[model samples]
Target: MQIDAHQHYWDPARGDYGWLTPDLAALYRRFGPADLAPLRERAGIARTVVVQAAPTVDETRYLLGLARDDDSIAGVVGWVPLLDREAPALIAELARDAKFKGVRPMLQDLPDDDWIANPALAPAIEALIAHELAFDALVFARHIDALQSFASRYPSLRIVVDHGAKPPIVEGPAGWQPWADRIAKLARLPHVHCKLSGLATEAAPRWTEATLRPYVDHLLASFGPDRLMWGSDWPVLNLNGDYLLWHSIATTLLDVLTDAQRDAIFGGNAAAFYRLEV
Candidate 1:
């Protein structure tokens, strides 16, 4: 069963996505199972993990509600006020739903790059560990060092670095080395996982298989297929390419690997990390 492990659905009228503004024309409209159905079908992605696009519990609940009705959504990586004193209680409340797989705090949008390292948020991380839910680190390279320390502090927390820590793809070869080095360090933590997603959007109009190959190569070598997973990051991915195109590019990158390795990166690893029933 193929899984596109990190995609999102949103409506503009909700007013929760402070980032989903009119400037992002490609993603300014509503996207739902209907919008994604054709893409997933074309890509042969049987299931998906609907991740949060807004940093609101209302949006999280909206995604979870969709997951409850839509079998195509295997689970959801929703959001919570991770630093709030009530975070553990909120996590416990969300955990009651079988489809609630994890939490992401929109770290990339935060003003403080070291926000994840705040001691006040320790209870929320512990709650995720206790509940067997994952932590999707929506971080950029600027947050890598703190992320490494944070991941080390909670050795048992199932943390997955979204978008290979969203490397500086626009900077080309000069950008790949530092992010790759940090990825290697993060991979050393047995509990940490990496996602081969969002690179297309990062590369934008100039994206090509060649432009992304080196980064893909680094991730494959550093995490190996066993510790990595594939995600479409759709809707937002429309900013650069579509789901089928990303799938084709990913396939081309993984063509060198053995079938089992490809299988793990594309589906098995995500299933294991999210503990999806499929």
Candidate 2:
């Protein structure tokens, strides 16, 4: 079964998204399974992991409700205060819910960009490992080195790098080298994987396959087939392209690989990486 490994949902009524209010009007609208189904059906995506857009347990609970309402939501990667003193208890509580596949701390929002490398954060990573939960490292270019350090330190913890380091395809890869270098280093860690999503939004407004090839090729080469996954990064990816656009891009992009390699990138890797039985 094909899986759109990354996506999200939110209710404006629950709480206002500080990042979306006043501007970014198009993105400010709410998107639940009702918004996802037709797009997903057109994309031939059978399952998905609805990720958290905010940083709180309430977001996790909200996603859990979405998952329960929609069978296609195969898993969920929600947010929690990973650095909290009750990290273990919080994770334990979230663990009781099967749909809660993992937790993301929204590293970009943290005061210190290198929040992943903080020694105090090790307990959180350890707790995830113990709970058999995947940790989605939502990071930007500058945070790559610190992320690499965290991956190396906790080799047992499953870490999936979201958005291929969020490279600047608009800048034509000058900053990509260092990001690629870190991913190469990260690839050596058997527990690490890369998410092949959100790139269309990373490029110039009118970018085509040629413009994204360099970055896509780099990530495929760095992580290879065994560790790379296909994700839609829906709603967020709509910032640049829709689900159909991402599907077309991914299907065409993986055409050069063998069928098995293509299968892993499309869904096999996600099923294995996220431990989703489907």
Positional deviation of residue 224's Cα in model 2 after best superposition, in angstroms? 0.7
| Model 1 per-residue lDDT at 212 | 89
The lowest-lDDT stretch of 10 consecutive residues in candidate 1 is 171-180
Residue 138, candidate 2: how far off, in angstroms? 0.9
- Residue 170 local lDDT, model 1: 87
Candidate 2 lDDT over residue span 27-78, tens digit each: 7778899898998888788999888888778878888988888899989998
Alpha carbon RMSD to native, model 1: 1.0
Q: Assess the local accuracy of residue 7 in candidate 2 as a C-alpha lDDT between 0 and 100.
A: 86
lDDT of 1 at 235: 83
Instruction: Give the C-alpha lDDT of model 2.
Output: 0.83
Worst 10 residues of 2 by lDDT: 16-25
Each candidate's lDDT (Cα)? 0.91, 0.83
**Model 1, which residues run further than 4 Å from truth?**
none
TM-score of each: 0.98, 0.96
